[model samples]
Target chain A: MILTVTLNTALDITYRVRSLRPHTSHRVSEVTERPGGKGVNVARVLAALGHEVTVTGFTGGATGRVVQERLASVPGVVDALVPITCATRRTIAVVDDRSGDTTQLNEPGPTVTPAEWSAFQEAYEALLPTASAVALCGSLPPGVPVGAYAGLVRTARSAGIPVLLDTSGEPLRRGVAARPDLIKPNTDELAELTGSHDPVRATQDARRRGAGAVVASLGREGLLAATRDGRWRATPPAPVHGNPTGAGDSAVAGLLSGLIEHLPWPDRLTRATALSAATVAAPVAGEFDQGAYEELLGQVVVSGEASAA
Target chain B: MILTVTLNTALDITYRVRSLRPHTSHRVSEVTERPGGKGVNVARVLAALGHEVTVTGFTGGATGRVVQERLASVPGVVDALVPITCATRRTIAVVDDRSGDTTQLNEPGPTVTPAEWSAFQEAYEALLPTASAVALCGSLPPGVPVGAYAGLVRTARSAGIPVLLDTSGEPLRRGVAARPDLIKPNTDELAELTGSHDPVRATQDARRRGAGAVVASLGREGLLAATRDGRWRATPPAPVHGNPTGAGDSAVAGLLSGLIEHLPWPDRLTRATALSAATVAAPVAGEFDQGAYEELLGQVVVSGEASAA
Candidate 1:
């Protein structure tokens, strides 16, 4: 089973309105909610692909209870979230029916106390031994140390488990230094970390900063990987467009599952690229279009240079 | 004890952002939550005014639990909300910190099953006997009968209780015909019910439609009352500048309290006018500034002509 960590989990809520106007009242036509965070999303995709996954994070308050209840209904996923005092935060995506644009409003996550953080660390360590691989994901809630992910990465590595880190800002900067097996950052996060707009350069630069490998997700374009085996660029057959909300997380799931199965770098990239495209075509986030994934799987074009070293 | 019925209760959540821009992501700077709906707001104000108020409505799911928990913390308000199979609705008010403007997003109320509606009716009827006055408020949730409030008003009247109807649209249309002792309509509601924008004319017209008396709440201009004893206009000392989210509910609270106290029409209008102004001066909904209420109470001027008949 794979272990996923989301330190700052959220109850993602989507509301659809005819139009979004400032300082005006809107009647939300539809409302949908699910457990969300980078890790939770990855876990869902992995579970959908027949992988057994355990999710660990902070779950508290009424929102947290609802998140746990929803998670229980999903097959092949286990809940290991530690309890906290404060309620989990909610991220609202207000979708305008007219323009098909989404306005996002995110509440700051619950502040994890020092004791609660310690409890989570213990719980995470306890789960690492049985885990084939681990994914450290999302932001650090207030009160958790900024370098918290770095320590978690080290713990997973010390247990001889391959770990993937997916986050941004100072946490990513610090976590990379702890030498996680892999780090996935989208274009914006990649640019912020490596100060390079060019994807290839940023991916390579990120690897040089102690990440075992770097995969940069470029929206619509696809994935760029820089690893010990080689450098590769994988693109889908054609641009699949819809809601691209959880596409990156799908990519992360693809890469993690491939690593555990010992797929080659190119094959992994192909899977990741296809899964992302399928997720983009899905109506809801944290889900992939199975038919689209199957069709795109054989069509993903992977091109790169073999390592000279 | 005063009984208030809100067929469509809500968990009102307010998010404060630096500024509101459509199709963009915002980090909410502050968040606050409370039990809400027109009657809940009225009950809160009445309770604050030292009245023991009983609130009966439909409550279900996690949001409903949160609403009930919050209600239990309030001093003089009792929750008699009936359990339902579906969740209560949520109303989001996104307040822009910069411009002090609010953007509202309201989720439609949960559909009450026929059994749930019957349960609520039984609960409301059971509570009406001990009530000094009853206030029926807010929109009807889906699945509830359109003439639900009318039935409730008739039942209360049969019990010899003075009932105030404070809703609009077809519910108000049906409820007024039941001959509620009083109906409070704002300018828009009055216009919609009477097809006349003139407040005095519309108020008189509403009375002819079977409302025993009519009070039109005019924002900033205060309250205009057309009652059996006389016709009067009640004006606050000055315009209070603040959020007017629950001003109408506060006014309803004041009128119900005054009616039970057997105040004259002019005095009832004065109390309602002062409470409405005080609610506008409050920082949060369902609350009034006690200092403002006290100061404005004595300062509210009521002038009118006596009934010649």
Candidate 2:
């Protein structure tokens, strides 16, 4: 069973308006709501692809309840979030039709007290024995220590479960030190963390920081991965031209699924690109297009590393 | 007992930040969540001030469940909303500290299918006998006919209840024709409905259009009411400068509290002004300040019309 942790889950709301005039009233033509956050999105795609997954994090108040209820409704999803005092955050993506760009408004996640953090740690430890792989996604909420994910990674490693850490900033920095099996960082996140824009060099720097493997998701350019077997790059066919909100999470899902199934490096990259493209091509918010996934699987081209032996 | 109907109730979230930038990330310093909507706020303040209040309309889905759970926790409060398939809306209030002004991002309310509307009508009718006064508040959600509020007012009137309608646009236009006992339109809403910027003339026009009485909430200047006795202008103690987010709803709470207690028009205006000022002074997101209310009560001035006496 695959386990995902979303310390700061959100009830994501997207509103489509003709044009965005800040500080003014707007009559929204359409509105969409979904349970969202990096880990939640990853778990959803995996479940849709028929993977047994459990999502546990800190969810509280009404928003938290809604998130839990939504996870339950989705097939192959197990919700494991520990309750907290504060309500979970909500992230609003206001899409402007004229510009075709989304203006994001995010709420700072709820503060998880020391006791709540301890409770989550206990829950994760309890579930670690049965989990084949664990994916830690998103940022740390207030009152939670910066190295929270690092502690979880260490615990999962001690239990002999592969940990896939995908987060930015210091959380990634600290979590990498625990030597997680895999880390997925988008191009911007890779640059910010390693202070290097070159994906290949940044992946090497991240591996030196103690990550077993690094998969860098470069939005349109596609996925570049550095593993023990060799390095590989996969690109999708043309541009899918759709909302790229959960594309990276979908890539993470694909890579993790391939790892457990023991697929070759090139095949892993193909699935990763296919899933990422499928996420963007999906019409519904937070859903992946299965038809696109099947069509895209054949279209992704995987290239071997120029330097790898 | 005063009953307030918010067809599209919401979980009002206010995030306090230094400044708001479009397409850029913000770290909110303070966050607050409250059960909200025009009628919900009215009921909340009335309950806080020791008035019996019930909230009715359509509330369902997980968000709706949270609304009911939270309202149940508040003392002196009752709820009668019918269940619906869609989740209730969430209104985001972004407060910029530098300017101290609020930018509101409201979600379009949930769509109420014809079956859902029938359920709401049935539930509201059954509860009317228990309410001495009923208030129809906020805008109508999509799929609800324009004359929806008007029909609700007519139903309440037939049950011998004095209906107070607080809404805007077509809902307000159609609702007033049902001859609600009072319709409280803000200065802008009054102008929009009557096509007159002049408050006195606007109130007269609103009354002329079938509202038994017109009470226009004039920001900074307090409330202007045209009643059977005369036209009265209520002024707050000082310009209680704060986010005026829910001040109008607070005023409605005071007015309904006064009506239920059989207070004179002057006293009602005084209470309304005090409550509105208290809301500004409260500092808490959705609560009115009781201390401010007590202090402002003595400072409120009610001056009657020159022509009516």
Candidate 3:
């Protein structure tokens, strides 16, 4: 089973209006909600791909209850979430039907007391032993140590579990030093981490900072990998245009699932690239179009030339 | 004790953002939640004025639980809410800090099943015996009979309780035929009900259609009241400018409280006008500045001119 940790889980709400004009009242034509966060999104995609996934995170208050209740319906997903004192946050995306554009409003997640942090640490450690691979994803909510992911990485390594860390800012800077099995940084995150705009050079620099392997997502351009054994670049047949909200999480799911299945690096890269493109082509996050995924699976080109990174 | 019935209750959420640009993302800086609906807001204002207020409405699901929990904090306000199969609605007001303009998105309230409506009616009848006065306010949710308020008005009247009906559309038209003790209509609602945009003629037409008394809210111009005893027009000291969202609800609270206190027609009109203006001058809904209420109380002009109506 794959284990994913989301420190800051959210009740994702989407409001659809005819036109999202500033300073005007809207009769939201429709509203949709789902359990969300980077790791939760990753786990959902992994489960959809026929992997048994266990999700651990903080959930509290009414919104948190709703998230857990919704998660109960997804098959092969275990809820090992820890309860907190404060309610979970809600992220609203206002979709304008006129222009098909989305405006996001994100609430700052609940603050964790010191005692809650220790409890979460215990829970994470307890869940780590039964997992073949673990994923530490998303932002560090208030009251959590900035280096919290680094400690979790060490724990997973101690348990002999393959760990993948996906985060940005100071958390990423600190977690990279713990040497996770893999790190996926998008173009902006890579630039923010290594101060280099070029994906290939930044991935190399990120590896030098201490990552077993570095995979940088370059948006529509696809995934670039730099590892100690080799370097490769995987590209989709064409640029897929749709909501790219959870594309990176789907890519993470692809890589983690492939790792557990013991696929070669080239095959893993192909799956990751195709899954990312399929997610981008789908209507919502964490869900990929199976038709698109199957069609693009055979078409993704992975070239390993040492200079590909 | 004042009893206010909100058939369609809501969890009011306010989000603060730097600027609300369509098609762009926003990092909401602040979030605030409150129990709200027209009757709920009226009850809150009455409770703040030192009256014991009981709020009854439909509450179900997680959002409904949050609404009930929030009401527990307000002193002198009792929650006599009824449970339903569907969850109560949520109303979100996105406030743009840069422009100070709010974009409102209101969810259509839950559809009340037949059994739920019967249960709510039973609850309302049980609470009516102890109420000094009763207020039936706001829109009717889906699956409820449009003439539901008319039957409620009859129930309150049968119990010898003075009932005030505040709503719009077909419900308001049918409710007027029941001859509710009082009916409060704004300019637009009055126009739609009486087919006249002129407040004076529209108010007279509303009374002629069987309302015992009619109070017409003229926005900045204040209130115009036409009762069996006499007719009067109450105007504020000056044109108060601020959020007018809950001003009418405050006016309803003022009238309800004054009716229970045995105030004269002119005195009731003056208090209603002052409270309405005070609520408008305040920063948020359902709250009145005490100083503004006191200052406007003495200055409100209640001219008992026959030509006022």
Candidate 4:
């Protein structure tokens, strides 16, 4: 079973209004909610791909209950979320019907108490033993130590479980230094971490910083990976134009799933690139188009050289 | 007990962001939730004024649960909300810290099924016998008949309970014809109802259309009323300005409480005017400043003539 950790889980809500205007009241014509966080999104995609996945995170209060209830309905995904006292945060995406633009309002996640953090670490360790691969994803909620992912990555390494760290800023920098099996950082995140805009240099610099492998998601351009086995650039056959939300999580899901399946580096890149493109093309956010994924999987172009070492 | 009916109850959420720009992501720094709807707001103010208040409405789903839970925490307020299958709506007031302006996003209330509507009417009828006065407030949720408030007004009257109707549009129009004991319309609602921007003419016109009495809330100018006892204009000693969000509801609470207390028309007007001004002076959106209310109560100027009869 693949394990995904979302320390700062969210109940994502989308509201559709005829048009958005500042300081005026709007009547939202539609509302949609989904259990979300980077890891949760990755878990959902993994489950959809027929992988047995367990999701662990801090969930509490009414919003958390809604998230858990919705997560329960998704097949092949198990909820192992740690209970906390504060209500989980909510992220609202207000979509304007007129221009198809979205204004986002995000509430800060519940602050994790020290005891809750300790309890989460214990729960995560308990799940690690049976997990084939683990993905540590998203931002750290307040009150959790700054080096949270770094410590988690070290634990997974000690347990001999492959882990993929997908986060940004301090967490990612610290997690990378813990030498996770893989890290998938989008272009902005990669640039932030390595202080370089050059994709190849940043990806390689991330690996040298202790990531076993680095896959940088360059939206539309696709994935660039530097790994122990090889370096590869994978791109979708044609540019897919749609909502890019959750595309990165799909890439992470693809990479983790391919790793568990023991796919070669180039094949993993192909799957990751195709899945990311498919997610962008999906009518609904956080879901991949199965037909697009299958077709693009065969069409993704992969070019790279095997590592000389 | 004073009974307040919010057919379209809501979980009112306030998000404080540094700034709110359209189509841009905002990180809300603070969040506050309150049980809201015009009736709910009235009930809270009545409860704060030491009146035993019973709140009944259709509540369902997670957001409804949150509303109910918060209502339960209010000291003198009783939650008698009827259950439904659909979730209650949420109204988000995004407060921009930089500019102190608020953008409101209101979700359309749950579509009340016929069965649920019937159930609510039954619950409302049961509560009416014990209620000294009933207040029908806010818009009718979808699926409720347009004449819902009219039917409810007639029911309360039949039970010998005076009903105060506080709503706008067709609901208010239909409810007025049912001869509710009192109808409070703001300047805009009055204009819409009577086709007259002149508050005195509109208020009198509203009364002739069937309201036992008409009270027009004229923002900073104060309250103008045409009642069986007299015609009066009540104004605060001076303009009280702050957040006027719930000032109208506070006025409704004051009028209802004074009516049940058997206060004279002039005294009722004074109380209503003071409470409205105090609500505006309060730091919080829906609460009235007790000190301000007490201070303003004595200072409110009421000038009127007793009806010739």
Candidate 5:
């Protein structure tokens, strides 16, 4: 079973309005809510791929209760969440139907107290022993140390579990030093991490900084990888156009699932690329188009020096 | 004691964003939640005035729990809310700090099941015996008959309790037929009810349609009342400016309080007008500035043939 950690989870809500005018009132035509965060999305995608995944995160207050209730509905995913005093944050995405534009409002996640942080650490240690691989994802909530992921990475490594760290900014910088097995940074996050516009150079720089492997999502350009065993560039069969919100999480699920299956680097890249594209084609984030996935799996081109050999 | 009915109560949420742009994202700087609805606001103001107010309506789910918890904090107010199977709705007010503009997104309230509607009716009947007056406020949720308020009004009248109806559209048209002791309609609602934009003419017409008294809120022009006792026009000393969202609810509370106090029509009009102005000056809806209320109360002028006395 793969374990995914979301330190800052959210009750993701979407409101549909005819149009969003700055100072006007709207009778929202529709409302929707779902459990959200990078790791939650990854766990959901992994579950869809028939992987048994356990999700651990901090949840509190009324919003947290709703998130837990939603998580209960998803099959093959286990909730191992820690309780906190503060309510889980909510992320509102107001969709303007006329303009097809989305206006997002993200609340800062609950502040983690010292006791709560300690509790989470204890919980993480308990969950690590049974995990084949662990993915530490999303932002560190308030009161959590910047190097919190580093400690978790070290624990996972000690347990002989392959760890994947996906985050941005200072947390990524500090977590990299702990040497996670894999790091998935999108184009912007890659630029922020390495300070280089060139993807190939940035991937190599990230690997040198302590990441055992670097898989960089180039948005529509597809996936670039630099690993000790092999390096590969995987491209989608066609340019997929849709909401790209959770594409990266789906890619992480693909890579993790492939890793557990012992697939070759080229085959893993193909699966990851197809999954990313299929997620974009699906109506909502964290859900993939099974038909699209099946069609694109054999079509994705994984061409690199290692794959050629 | 005043009983305020909010059949479609809401958890009012406000999100403060720096600026709201179409298709963009915002990190909300702040989030505030309060129990809200037309009747809930009325009850809060009545409670502030030292009146024992019992609030009844549908509340369900986690949001409803928060609403009840918040209602507990308001002194002299009782929560007699009915429970439904579905969750209560949320109304979001996104305030753009840069432009000082507010964008509203209201979710449709819970769908009331047949059993839930019967339960609410039973609770409403049980509370009417203790209420000096009843105010049926806000819109009816889905599955509720358009004549729901009309039935409630008849019940209050049979119990010898003065009932105030403050709703709009078809509900208003149907509710007025029950001969409620009072009906408060804003400019647009009055126009929709009587098909006349002229406040004086519309108020008289609304009274003719079976409303015992018709009080029309004419925005900054103040209030126009055509009652069985006499006709009166009450205005604040000067036009007040601020958020006018809950000014009408405050007016309803004032009128109900005056009715129980056995104040004459002119005095009631003066009190209601002053309260409305005070509410506009308050930072939030349903709350009034005590100083402003005192000053405006003495200054509000009531003029009509009856005021000449």
Candidate 6:
């Protein structure tokens, strides 16, 4: 079983309009709602691939109830949420029909008190020992200590569970120091973290910072895997265009599922790359076209290189 | 006592950003939430002015609970919501800091069942006998009978309560034949309803259809009130710039407050115009600048003209 932690979850609301007029009234053509958070999205994709997944996070108020209910309703994912005092955050995506672009308005997520963190840690510790791997994903909410993900990674390591850290900025910087088994950062985020735009160089920088392996997701380009076995790149069969809201999460799901399936490094990279491509091409957030992914997986070509030493 | 009906209420959410960039992420500078609907906004302003207000409408689910909680928290307002299975709608306002303009995205309200409408009608009938007037406001949700407001206004008239209808689309078209004592239509809505851009001619056309009085809210230009007592044109001292959401609703509150206060036609027109101006000048929705309104009320010049008929 894979344990995924989404510290800050949201009720994602997407509105479709002909065009986004900055200061005008618009009649939206449609509205779509979903449970959103990096880890949740990862778990959704994993469950779709028939992986056993447990999602844990902080939730509160009516929006929290909505997130929990929606998460539970998804076929194969298990929800384990810690109750808090504040409502879950809401993320609005305004899609402009004419330009096919999206404008995201995200609310800073709810604050989690020290006591709530302690409760969450306890729940996580109990689950980690029974899980194959733990993925710490998403942003840190207010009131949470900046090094919260590091603490979670340490606990999972203590339980002999391999931890995969997927986050950005401060949390990512701090968590990387704790020596997680894997760290998945996209091209820009990789460049931001390592100051190197070259995928090989950035992956090397990430691994040197204590990540045992690094999977770099390059938007439209493909996936780069830097593991102990070797370095490999897998590209999708064709380039696809759509909203890339959950592309990174889908890659994380692919990487984690690959590990659970005991696939070789090359096959794992292929799977991650194909799934990420499918996610980028998906019409909605946190959902992927399985058939597209499967077809893409068969076409992925992985050329190997010596591991960074 | 004044009665306000928001058949499809909302939890109005506003997000303030420096600019709206499509398909890009934005960090909201500020956020505000208020209980809203056309009638709800009217009730809020009236309550601030120290009027006895009872809101009678269909409300259910968590969103409805939030609305009820907010209304209960505000002083000088009473809630008498009839229960329904559907949750109330939510309205999103995205404001651009540079342009000082708002982009409003309104959700389709809950589908009200026939049983729900019947229950709501019973609740309205129970409240009408004790209320002095009724303000029917906002769009009718799906599953609600198209002429829902017409039936409601007839019930209010039977109880000797003057009904004021404020809505648009088919609901307004159907409800007009019920002969509401007052109908507050904006300039464009007035043009759409009467098929004339000229406010003076359009107002007479509105009265000819079924309204006893037509209080046309002409935004910055001001108020045009055609009543049994007399017709008056009231304009503000100056055009105040700010978020104008709910400004018309505030005008409805001012007009209703004046009627209960026994202010003459001219005084009522002036007060309503000032309140509308104050609402437009306020930084937030459902909030009016009392000092500005008081100052502007004194400057409002009410002029009269004999009817062409």
TM-score for chain B of all predictions: 0.98, 0.95, 0.97, 0.99, 0.97, 0.96
| i-RMSD of all predictions | 0.5, 2.0, 0.8, 0.6, 0.9, 1.5
Give model 1's docking category: high
Best DockQ among the predictions, by candidate number: 4
Q: What TM-score would you give candidate 2 relative to the actual structure?
A: 0.88
- Write model 4 residue lDDT over B40-72, tens digit each, in one string: 999999988899999998899999999999998
Q: Count clashes in each candidate, considering only residues at least 3 apart in sequence or on different chains.
A: 0, 1, 0, 0, 0, 2
Clashing pairs in 5: none
Compose the digit string of candidate 1's lDDT tens values, residues B192-228: 9999999999999999999999999999999998988
TM-score of candidate 3 versus the correct structure, residues matched by position: 0.98
Q: Per-residue lDDT for B45-131 in model 3, tens only?
A: 999889999999899989999999999999999999999988899999998887888989888789899999999999999999999
**Candidate closer to the true structure by TM-score (higher is better), 3 or 6:** 3
Candidate 6 interface RMSD value? 1.5
Q: Which residue pairs clash in candidate 2? A: A57-A81
- CA-based DockQ, model 6: 0.67
**How many angstroms is residue B243 displaced in model 4 relative to the true structure, after the best TM-score fit?**
1.4
Q: Summarize candidate 2's per-residue lDDT along A1-309 as a digit string, tens digits.
A: 999999999988788877876666667777777789999999999998889999989899877887877778988999888899998898878787898777777888888899999999999999999998999999988899999888999999999998999999999999999899999999888998899999999998999989999999989889998888788889999888888889999999998999889888799899999999988988765578999999999999999764446
lDDT of 3: 0.92
Error of 3 at A206 (Å): 0.5
Instruction: Report the C-alpha lDDT of model 6 over B13-127, residue by residue, as the tens digit.
Output: 8888888776679987777777888888899898888888998787877788888888898887899998888778888888888987777888778888888888888888888
> What is candidate 6's lDDT per residue for A7-95, written digit by digit as tens?
99888988888988766788777877788889989999999999889999888988888888788899889998889998999898888
Query: What are the runs in model 4 whose C-alpha is more than 4 Å off?
Result: none
Higher-TM-score candidate among 2 and 3? 3
Lowest lDDT block of 10, candidate 6 chain B: B300-309
Native A-B interface contacts kept, per candidate:
0.89, 0.52, 0.84, 0.93, 0.88, 0.68
Candidate 2's residue-wise lDDT over B1-309, tens digit each?
A: 788999879977777888877666677777776788889999988889888888888886776887888889889888777888988887777778898767777778888999999888888888888898998999888788999999999999999999899999889998988899999999989999999999999999999999988889988889999987788999986788876878999888888888888898889999999989888888776578888889899999989864435
lDDT of 5 by residue, B34-123 (tens): 999999999999998899999999999999999999999999999999999889999988888887678888998889998999999999
Query: Which of 1 and 2 is ahead in lDDT?
Result: 1
DockQ-based CAPRI category assigned to the predicted complex of candidate 3 = high
